[model samples]
Target: MAEPTERDPLIQKPTVFTDADSASRGEPATKQRLGPLEISASNRRGILAGIWLGTFLGVLTLVPTMMPSISSEFQKFHLASWLGTAYLLATCTFTPLYGRLSNVMGRRGANHTAIAFTAIGTVMCGLSRNMESLIAARFIAGIGGGGLFTTATIIVSDMYTLRNRGLVHGVASCFNGLGMGLGGPFGGLITDLLGWRAAFLLQIPLFVFALILIQYNIRYVTPGKSKGTMEMLKRIDYLGSLTLLVALGSPLFFLSARYNESLPWSEARVITPLILAIVFILGFLGVELFLAKEPVLAPGMLQQKVPVLVGASNFLVGACNFSVTYFYPMWFQVVMLQSASTAGMHLMPNSVSMSIGSLFAGWMMHSTGRYKRINLIFGIFPFIGTTLISRLREDSGPIHSWLSIIPLGFGNAVALHTMLIALLAHLPESHMAVGTGFAQLFRGIGQVLGVAISSAIFQSRLDAELRKRFHVPDAENLIRQIRRNSNYIRELPSEQQAYARDSYALALKTVYIFAACLTISAYLVRLPIPDQDLDKAHARQRAQAEARRNSTAEVATTNAVASTSTGSGLPTPEYPARSPTETETEPEEPAA
Candidate 1:
């Protein structure tokens, strides 16, 4: 046969890893060895737990604060928007694929692939020679970065029982919050001290260490028989993946072009892509529902009411969270006239609040075994915070700025932790990876939408305000220059500087109001999620485990008796059989 093409799937061979899932199902584990130390199934989870903080910190170094510096170096501040957009787009495109890919490659293989891609992309980013190359490099890194969090969540679900999963997730999210919290200041400081390229170059060592950790901890048990490469490749849903990409990318292109090109909504440049996006989305739905076998999105995954609502809520949460993250620094740096490093410092309150809120939400769920009330109570924070932030003036104080950001951070973190558990609780164990992947996909798209929408609004408002305020003979050219490079605001007369700052402050108010509306919508969607009793679910799992152990021991005793009787030429001894209450219980699927 001819060799596989580039488009052919790249799934790993069907070798069993013999993880805790199989051991729980009573399947005999295959012995594996590399050298002196033997790898055990029970200890596999320690791999990620040991390195969770470094893992997120390495990937989530948000560099929005460095945009001015990076743009200045490239001499194209107008195109700086693509820096964040490209990363979010690539992440959104590939995140769902990793979920299905993990099932075929095993988590260990999938994780290594993600890390390797990230390392390569990070180096490429550091070495980039122009704006386009940097954007391309960020896209590549995002492909890997997206999977890091998705796979970590899947592994966490596998490692813990539902009884304590909340706390475990909370701890994991706390590390994520730390990474988000620290990444800004760290990136800004690096940019200030050594330049922005060092920010990307410095992360390479952490990823290298992560790979060593995975290699030593996760051991694979070879399978008795494996399928051919072509057979496994044919099982992947290539059409669905491509169609989904188009469905998401087309609209993004429309929104981005509309702003970057300064085109009207009715212009063919914007209208054509919008129409194409709708058609492709419809095509994607049909492919998932009928054409693909073992769809990237499993059947009824979002067809159920709970999953649909959860996915929608996550989308809005993503919008609310990312909108603030991307623009909050801009508020400090442009309007308040702080240095990049100082602006990043101002982000500390938001990030710290997220860490505290995640832990609190986790503790509540672990203690009470409930999530509905927790979600409702926390969901209100984003709306309140956004509404308050909308009231900011050009002369707002540090206390006002810090106080406005805290509610957004705290509420969004709680919503993220609770929503994941809620989504998993409704899905079957087999669908956990895909379900979680879809959740990430939704949130990633929301990040892109949030930033894109906010950018468009900011640009339009800034242009209008500049025209209205400036009475110079060359006002239009001056406005364009100021819009392209925020640094130009400093070059203007002191009176013009005040006007420019006021324009930014007013435009941002509109953006915050838009985010506030999304938070309200998220709260409404969350109200109807059905509550599952986490404690009862924990009890059921324990009962089933005990049944399996008793059944295994009984079989061992019967085998010994028969062997003895045959050796002595005596009749086998009679033994009492288990009663209905003592009989083996039908095994239930593991809780997420």
Candidate 2:
């Protein structure tokens, strides 16, 4: 095959490596060998990128814990549910966009854009005087947050080979877990002492630090390079982006309306958006397959079984994860009668366990270079945990509640991260950003769907139970009050409070069962994933790259010898063909 010329689209300038000239000046070699693994001198770039990404995510996780306080202060209790939903909606919508953007704009540019959005949105949230403004600000922040996560993963792919990526991913996940785990308690404590706005304000400086770290440390080849801003814009799949936005945004709107307004599924408010969402999704798919020059979601990606299966499994995992995260605190507050801060404390076990599980899985993958069995074996924990959580009652103690989540958190960490590793394994290096982004898209979808479905189930059960137990004229008012303020249960008569707690617990049980089912379903989907050796794959890739470089060098030498012989009237030396084991083998004849 002909070597790539300078103008070839596949020709990428190496950003991570130092030239021989630079190395002669005592600079470290770009690539270093350590046992079976090849480590880049600039691997610190990937580490810093992961840290920044994790810290930003940790700040974002603070919202769920602060939701109650925001509701109480704003007197817009009904809109509080939208805080997480809105952020998730924006995240899902922008995830694929950011993936494609990173491919086009380079990781540094894309990440910086995301950080800017996050910082601005965070400041907006801090200054907002009402729930509507806060929700809008969260949506804005979600766009940046989504990009931060997607780009961070893509950057890791750029820096690390598949064999080593799992450990880095796990470390990053630990940071994410730390952020998410502490978010609740920290948000609660901060809100209690300084107010909810302080939670938003505190992240601004951290985001700035992340921005600076990424700017200075992270470097990679830009997949999609352009001469100017206009050229970059021209390359974007605008129609596909619009269609995707509508496709994702519409369903979220429908679900939010359905739950917040308590509207019937058949109502025009819900049905209209639901139909529109479907239409837009179909349109987006069509654009990807047929029309766009550079489809946001590559069409070929859909044809691959591994990516499809991994994405599907990720969707289920995402749903289970968000449902548990969102509802666990609610369960503590409503059924157990804990304050927001106390409820945040109750979530410590799951977060800590999740971090531990992620680290363990990462270590296992790094050591063994295998993950299929890990995914299969650890996948059962969430199912077991959720099953037990489904049985939690008013009488369940702190230990019972806390311990139940450990397995779920542990299982989720292992399965979800493994699936990600599997996905990166399945796709070519060129498509890594898009693949990671797509996985995150599914995760965002799962979160939105999980919250919406759980809310629907909880609302229906709570309403039915309240109506059946109370025949008084003010039963509707009593139900509304209970829904508005979980704390109101403590003021009710002892028998009434018992009934309320039982009703809430029952509703939560149903949600937990649903989450459990989703977890098991994800495991089943993951069963078909082939166990491939990541180390061997990386080795093969390195060999191919080396072969290409060798071929190019040999061709240059042959051309120089021919030119010298022709000019000097000297006999050209005949070279014997090299054997397979030779470092420099004979090049193939040029194709006709």
Candidate 3:
């Protein structure tokens, strides 16, 4: 009988051996450095699959555990924010660490470490006794969660021809969104109905499910080489890692508490963390240039054309997204006078739109694999949408009001996912983590400012407008007071509420305008991406590297055969290759 074809799954590429070949060779899954790329087709599949799976698994694990009904019984909003932030910083922090670790342990071990992180963190979060304990537990979860988005993306480069990546990205993101939507609502309900601790328990089943899938579908990962371990270690910038941890994690930590406490903005509570971040960042940069054997998150990586320019564009997109996500609900709550539930319902359109946008990008990417142009085109849509959305007046009808946001949402989904996918296309296989990691890092940094900038725009305008319309003696004071809490707003008369809402609307308009501007800046970067069929291009590079290896081996075989197989001093074969013009480009210091 004829064998079944490889087309069983819509996105799965055809494979000749199902990585069964690795099992037969009895190759120890130990690390082997082969130029820049690692070898282990099956392991990469599991790792990649797990990364995508973990993104959903790791994130949603928080859902069923939310304690909306009993904040005292579970955790408060501040504590919950830690869960999400910890995950974000953890993912960012681990990217370089994983890249280096991939070199040391091979992809299989590095990938599995991520799973272990998720399992342990989930348990700790579920069992936490206080807010601080939960925060610590979630930080651990972040280490695992970091692997979810970063490494899965790296595997796309490691495992497939460039032609196939768009399809894979689609499948990966679709699952990610599905997990988020399901994780957020269902988890919330579980916490609301059962208990907050129940949310963390949700991950228990997901971890088991992932294990089953990992066993069934994957068995191996790309392994690094054995040479230069000591030399590489010496170059390792240990201080750089510390600096990065502080530079990023510290600032966000401060921002989380920025609004919670009253401050001079110059006090040590704020100044201390900020100072630490600056010092470390400078120290990290210095070590990267002069001291380390191998710098983590190299400056060259971020400064290059693809990584920096593209990353900057994404930062803008991130800024817009971060702003919109924070303020939209606020508009509904304060202006529309809706409860949290109703505000969420208002947000459903954009959320659902993002999900659909992700699916659409996936399908289009898979069918055509010519996604670069579409990436650019769709990016503009959100920019325009946001621009239009920002123009809505105080009296704008609901139908006309939100239509602009739909386009921006579509634009947003495509811009971020597409740009992220685009990073791998331009970068070498070696620097995939660096490329994706720093882009996301910039985005994270941008998000912090996005909120601040958007808030400042909204609140400042609101203050001026309130003063103009109502002649309030302390409009600026009112804004500062309200930001601390809403209790003060409730004291105002009905006419005051109406006037404040208009001022709030004006503030929101300016913020949305800022969002649109950020989105537009992304377009300039996309125009210069030098779109090659990256999956195919990268595959060509690897295939060429393999050919060189085989040629070297063949010469060794010929010499041995010609020498009558008697020489005790037989040497490893030299690599064979085409002439310089014909040879494939080995990625230089800066891969992008």
Query: How accurate locally, in lDDT, is each candidate?
Result: 0.72, 0.72, 0.59
Estimate TM-scores for all models: 0.83, 0.83, 0.73
Error of 2 at 182 (Å): 0.7
Clashes (N, CA, C under 3 Å) per candidate: 0, 0, 16
lDDT of 2 by residue, 499-539 (tens): 88878887777888889999999989889989889987677
After superposing candidate 3 on the true structure, give the runs of residues whose Cα lies further than 4 Å from its correct spot: 1-51, 59-84, 122-134, 180-184, 195-197, 221-224, 227-238, 253-262, 363-369, 388-404, 447-511, 534-539, 547-592
User: What is the C-alpha local distance difference test score of candidate 1?
Assistant: 0.72
State in Å the error of residue 66, model 3: 7.3
Clashing pairs in 1: none
lDDT of 1 by residue, 362-455 (tens): 9999999988899888879988888888888766776887778889888988888888888777665545677888788788878778877777
